[model samples]
Target: MPELTTRIGDLTMRSPVMLASGTVGYGPEYEGVIDFGATGAIVTKTITVEPREGNAPPRLVETPGGLLNAIGLENVGLERFLAEKLPEAAPLPVPIVASVAGTGAGQFAQLAAAVGERDEVAAIELNISCPNVERPRNPVWSDPVAVGEIVSAAREATGKTLSLKLSPNTSDILSVAEAAERAGADALTVANTLPGMRIDIERRRPALGNVTGGLSGRALMPVNLALVWKVAEHVSIPVIGSGGIGDTGDALEFLAAGAVAVQVGTALFATPEAPSEIADGLRNYMEENGFASIDELVGMAREERRTCAETA
Candidate 1:
């Protein structure tokens, strides 16, 4: 069998497929639904310093090719997560990546220091790009300078792998990505979700209670894939692509685009077995194609593009 091992900085995963944050609740919500063994790691819902009630009702709207959500990072507070959720997740065979967001850079450092001290947690994913919040302050990932400050502070506070989850809603994504890398980010999650809204003609109002929401699913593939390719090429850190990955083909596309790993999100809402199915498909494909490991498949498209460019 081919080796499916993938490395995101010093953190090594058994497979390249990971369950995205917010999709799976604190790890117990999907008990009988999906097999945890199929995935390399699982990122808990984005936890904050305090428990969040989240946005108003009607937090989700089904769009044509995607799902719009304004869930607002509803999660257990830091204390509860560390005291309860983390221990509950410790029994799972896979690695646990704690997804966290703070009101500011200092809070991020504090949260990282607390979470990183736990033995059960394998890595820290900074959700600095979430667009669903009410915005008492500007999002950290929106500005390159703030991104640097937050990432730097968190890096200093944690010894575990730090993956900066970036946003695509910015003017220059490349600059933001470079800034995170310079601030000591071990890895980068290419993106979160696109800001979009659907109008309710019948109600003469917005479909989501939050008025605006983040879009996910197949529709996000093209744009996010391009971003993953660009950011992966520009930064030296590992890139974990998260967007519209629904199947093996979608995951393969992200890997080819230069992502070291792919996070399965919206797919889990409907097809809970997607991560395992995709992982199986990837293994079969690698065996058939004579590729020994995920590293060989990563960035194949970029290398092809480079060769084509040189030839042209």
Candidate 2:
């Protein structure tokens, strides 16, 4: 059997299929519905320093190929997460990756430190660039300087593995990835949801409460794969490909493009069992292909391109 286990920084994941933040609702929501053992890790919803009620109603709308959500990082505050949610998540079989977002670098540092203090958390994923909020704050990942500062602060606050989630809305993703790398990020979640919106013609208003929201689903697979390929070429740290992974094939595309792991997000809304099914499919595909480990598949596409170029 192929070795499905992989490492991101110091944390070892049994599989490379993680449930993306905000999709799984703190790891325990799908307990009996899905097998937790099959997933690499469960990243909790992005938590904030204070409880946010999130935006007004109509926060989500279904689009042609994806979902547009403006949830606004609504979650139980840090205190509630630590006191209530963490305990519930601690008993799960897979590792817990706490996802956090904050208004500023200082708040981000505080959130990271608080989450890191928990023995159950295996890693921290920094949500530095959510696009659905109504606030006028600048995204930390959009500027290399801000990326470095925020990542540095979080790095200092957490001893656990740190994974920085970058925004697709940024002009130069490579520069932001490099900034995160230089600031001591252990891993990079190549890209987040793209900014998008829809209007209700009948109501004469925006489809989402926040007016615009982040888009995620099948449409983002190619975009996310390109990002993974590009970031993998420049950064030495592991890259966790995210955005639109929906099945084994989608996940394999990311692996072939050079992501060490992949996160399944929008798919879970439709099929709760998607993650485990993809993991099983991966194992079967690896064995059938005579690959002894998942690592062999990582960056295979890049190698093929290099070989073709050399021949030419």
Candidate 3:
């Protein structure tokens, strides 16, 4: 069998397919619905310093090919997560990557230190790109300097492997990615959901209560794939691609494009077992194609492109 093990810094994942944050609701929600051992990791919902009520009703609106969500980072506070949520997730077979978002560098550092200390948490993902909340300061992922500051602060606070979840909303994602790499991020989760909205024509109001929400699903795959490719080309750290991935083919595309791993989010809403199924498919594909490991498949598309350009 082809080796499915994937490593991001010091952390190792059994498979390249992981459950994206906010989709699986920690690790216990899908106990019977999906196989936890099949996936590489589980990124829990974005936790804040305090518990959030989240946006008002109508938090989700289905578009033609994607889901627009304004969940507003609703999650249990750090204390509860450590005491309750983390303990509940203890039985999960894979590593637990705690996702966190905060208002500033200090807050991010605080959250990172708090969660990074827990034995249940294997890694820390700094969610600096959540679109639902309104903040007085600019979004951290948009500015390279801010990205450096936030990532650096979190980096200092955590001994655990740190992955920075970036945003696609910015103009120059490569610069931001490079900044994160320089700031000591172990890995980068390329490109979060795109900002979008829909209108309820009858009511003449926005479909989502938050007016604007992040767009995610099949529609986001191509866009994020390009970002992953570009960012991977520009950075040395591993990149974990996330956006729209429903099956093995989608996962393969991201891996070939230069991602070490792929995260499945919106697809879980429709197929809870997608990560496991995709992992199996990946193994089957590698075996049939004679690929030795996931590393051999990673960045194949980029290599092909480089070869073509050289020949041309």
Error of 3 at 150 (Å): 0.9
- Which 10-residue window in model 3 sums to the lowest lDDT? 303-312
- Model 2 Cα lDDT, one tens digit per residue, 173-206: 9999999999999999978899999999999999
Q: What lDDT tens digits, residue by residue, belong to model 3 across residues 99-183?
A: 9998888999999999999989899999999999996456677889988999999999989999999999988898899889999
Locate the minimum summed-lDDT window of 10 residues in model 2: 132-141
TM-score per prediction, in order, is 0.96, 0.96, 0.96
lDDT of each: 0.91, 0.90, 0.92
Query: Candidate 2 — which residues are off by over 4 angstroms?
Result: 135-138, 304-312
What shift in Å separates residue 259 of candidate 1 from its native position after superposition?
0.4
After superposition, the stretches of candidate 3 with alpha carbons farther than 4 Å from their true spots are 304-312
Candidate order by lDDT, decreasing, is 3, 1, 2
Candidate 2: give the clashing pairs.
Answer: none
> Which tens-of-lDDT digit does each residue in 119-205 have in candidate 1?
998999999888999665556677899889999999999888999999988879988899999999999998899999999999999
lDDT of 1 at 112: 99
Error of 2 at 74 (Å): 0.5
